[model samples]
Target: MLDFTNDSSGGEPSSQAVKQDAISDQALLDAYSNAVIDVTERVGPAVVRVETGSKTPGARERGGLGSGIVISPDGLVLTNNHVVGSSRQIRLRDNEGIVTEARVLGVDPDTDLALLRADGARELRYASLGNSKSLRRGQLVVAIGNPLGFESTVTAGVVSALGRSIRSVSGRTIEDVIQTDAALNPGNSGGALVSSAAEVIGINTAIISGAQGICFAVASNTAQFVLSEIIRHGYVRRAYIGVSGQTAPIPRRHAVAAGVDNKMGALLAQIEPDGPAARAGLLPGDVAIRLDGVDIHGVDDLIRALDRDRIDRTLEMEVLRMGRLRTIDIHPIERKPSARQGSAP
Candidate 1:
């Protein structure tokens, strides 16, 4: 105590100030720990281990494992389609080692999502899906999954990015993906990516091999759409106007001639033989400017225009061919399960 109170004379903080700072730092750390613990306690029960066995004649013994999240009290579980592969029946095990069998209700390979119902499960604990569209970069997130066969593993990180597109195993582009830094491993697929409020914001999907802190999840909004479609129709229905194209810049003159203000459009590189677009006289080298009065600024826009509602419905397509605007009426058809050769827009 010789002159401890005079420590501030040299511009150094006094002992009391140092003590207060230490306390504040500890408080922040405690808050972070509490958040993770609280989320785990609230949502961990809904996380389950999904195990699938190969139905191959000689590979019946081969099996795979991943994670899943219970979304309905009556036992609807959501997981990645790749996790379950082509298996129609699988086993689920929760954190408490309760094992149950679940049957695949529906699967959408394009979005890498699958829905399952536990046999006779009722009043089960489940988690609520949150609006992933509201997530912001740098926001804290907690991942609860069974990583590498470790049941109920927990990892904490931040939302690194959003609106990302990733290719699924089925060779389809999954749009509006959520990128996060939360650690993920093989068995983590199909688990829940939760917010601080314990809402499931995403379904853990992929991780860049050999990369640290880089992971991706399917956004909850996409999952919700897939869920509803699967529940109502038994499969995801998408309109298909067979055309292969890419986004290309529109010529200023062509833009003016088309009476549209889009700077870019989908350049039709190929028209599927006898397909809807070809049947409607749409040819290669034509740039699509609008569909059903919706501006087709790019290939994505064109894809979005051909929604489920557009299937089997006559729609007007505006295009610029040889600098001249042309309107073509085409009826889109429902895309087939085996038809994954080209884009259907």
Candidate 2:
């Protein structure tokens, strides 16, 4: 939840020792800037210009511009679903100045991913997909998109972090996210974050307010899955369990001090009636310790575990119940499309 949206003031330290940190950071930036842009420019033409028109009651037509990626040869485009939310008209312009009307193939508001199709478009270029699983801190990456309607704009930086979760303006929590220092602006959503080889590793999605140079993106794998669903079902099928919990690892000192009396797992603070947790015999005071054999450290770990699962998938969970450890097998329910905006439990 590091807010990196709008602060442009450089964070320079006011001390001599800190000068070394600044020097090292600058060196990394220099390397990234010198090397990444060439690849971005070569592959950027496939990223399209998205123009959306909307009208409200008693209002004139409103228009906005965003960016999208070509995902298929016959003109399947991928973009942030928020960009096209309820728009009356959508137009796509590729790098060659060819503009065409497009239609939404599917929209997944939960992931903020949408698929669009432009008829009769041929020989469309596609960025190679990089394995998000292989992304590591300090690895270089480049973001290409249209910010302020400038097509194929490129910014370079390293993989600042991973496994982040951010809530979009549309109120859906995007999870398993990537964070970087690449500059992403208003019109950059759904553009590509590529590696040195021009493989699209991430989808530039959001930037935090009041912070400079910090940006977030959806990992390419997540985008691929969500986009595929948009093409097939016009929606994503997400699994849900009925429990609300904050992620905190069991502290060793707290365990020692309490002598087995205190909970030693993820603290469950709420439960919904007849929900998956309640139906599975879990209650308010339970602390979930493990999922399917994976140790649960915090909320992100649990969320990452459950985010993409299908409905009715059985998950083995170990929990702390009344000062004792207990195990349960819980079947996740299909979270209705309407409830996607609500907390799970």
Candidate 3:
């Protein structure tokens, strides 16, 4: 991937002499346009038009249209959870006009990402996940999708913003979202938000109905995390230590001792008896300093680190208690679905 930046001089073209091998200003413009076309060709094969239908009798037979990206040559695909919600009968068509049945591997509403396995995949073209954290504002980006059922449609634009938060259809807050003015349409959901060099950086997810050029994609980083868990466990998992806490600042000495940035931590207000933290010698008034190797700046940080992969694992932790730093080992358990309402995780 190019990892492009919109750092060119604004207003006028550069005055520096163009080298023999260098592309001129006019040629640069043509090259830019051609590069986008090339990217569309390179990544389009991996972009699949997804059609999901409801199996409920007496209901609408035809489902809606969406897009998806082939993430593995063995036929694993990624798309928005809403696109495949409660619908196991999924059909995918690639650029070669090959339509095939797909099986739902998993669906995670919290991140609005779902995984599918296409049937009879041989030499399937797939897109490589890029580092969404490396994306810069105004960098050149292209989206390949079947917008409005127009298969393999291509649109080019710059990234509008990064680290945005959008609400998922399941009413969960999707963090670290990618905002782009790439002109996504109704069938563009779950399409590939590709970089200049054709790396898949994000999966197109949503658009503001009344707004033009404002679209959102689930960041590739988040998709990677969700896909890994879904592939391994058939569902997204979260960990909790059975404690009530809130974000709080840490004492200067304790912060220095724990090597935590921002001098902040999660201050525990209550500890359930025989809970992981309580059994690990954590007191109700203690402030968690870190989990594993991740520094805890707040309760959110602690929660983010306690993902599905963290369950059943004994993680080293640091806490500030009684004006002293202490080390603790906690084995976080899975947070139950019933306890998810306004509860700490």
Candidate 4:
């Protein structure tokens, strides 16, 4: 007679082992749920609904609506510049249903970030910005925002990519952007993209329309820089060497001849007449390899090197022109607000 009894040592997992595996799986699921719950409980209160409008007689009653996060106990709120636009009046409503008037402290349209101060608000709940540089792909993140007029909605996702570049409404490229799979909608802009530790790692900014699971946020490091500059000055002071450029591959022969280790460079496609580059003898075809001893492998690299401190300062720019290395002394000037025509180096 064939053996009717079930064998415990068979290839299939035993009942006891299966029970233990189920328990482990449940534990992991519980941990993930608990983390989301904890972050929501801690950081959700700081997320506020931002409403902007113009008080003009003929202007629209409600101009724009989005989300913001209070980053200081004294109610310093951070949001997206696009959300506020050119509105003259801004109102904020916290999670507790307390409404307050806010005024724009400053705005950096290049980074798509804005800072606001709640009028006469004191001792308000706030969230802390975390180090976004430490974030890795696949790390869990939570997004808290007001989507489609809904207040304090939370969604969880993972960091899909890093070091992304996105274009701001002002037609500037925002570098080091964080890409995530978090579900974001029309009203989610200017909200908080939080890490599992309940720290604001990024500011939820843009969502690609017609694309699923593709969203972006301004990294907290970039936001922090914008915040400090706006607090100290009314606007971000960027150094400009007037030129329009694109990243181009350095020819192997040219790289070897010029003794440059860079595989790519910012090819100066156009130079403004009488601008810094033109005055410094930098031609349109010059490929910049270094700026003041710093590598300029691409346009973004060159842009970052020309910060506020570099304004009015003469810097040595290393370029490869006609397969020969040349050093040009260029003086960077303060970028004018009206000169937003092309990419400012």
Which number leads on lDDT? 4
Q: What is the full ranking by TM-score, best candidate first? A: 1, 4, 2, 3
Give the Cα error of residue 102 in candidate 1, in Å.
Answer: 1.5
Lowest lDDT 10-mer window, candidate 3?
12-21
Per-residue lDDT of 1-345 in model 2, one digit per residue for the tens?
A: 786444446764446547888999999888766677667676787798898995589997579889998877788888887788777589888888887888987777666777888766467777666789888998888888899888878888899999988875544568889999989999998888888877888888888889997899888898888877766666776677877888655655555544543334668888888888888888887778778777776554565567545367888888766656678988888765552244452
Residue 20 displacement in candidate 2 (angstroms) = 27
Best by TM-score: 1
TM-score of each: 0.87, 0.72, 0.69, 0.86
Error of 4 at 46 (Å): 0.4
List runs of model 4 lying over 4 Å from the truth.
Answer: 1-10, 55-60, 248-264, 321-324, 336-343
Per-candidate Cα lDDT values, in order, are 0.90, 0.77, 0.84, 0.91
| Candidate closer to the true structure by lDDT (higher is better), 1 or 4 | 4
**Candidate number with the higher lDDT (1 or 2):** 1
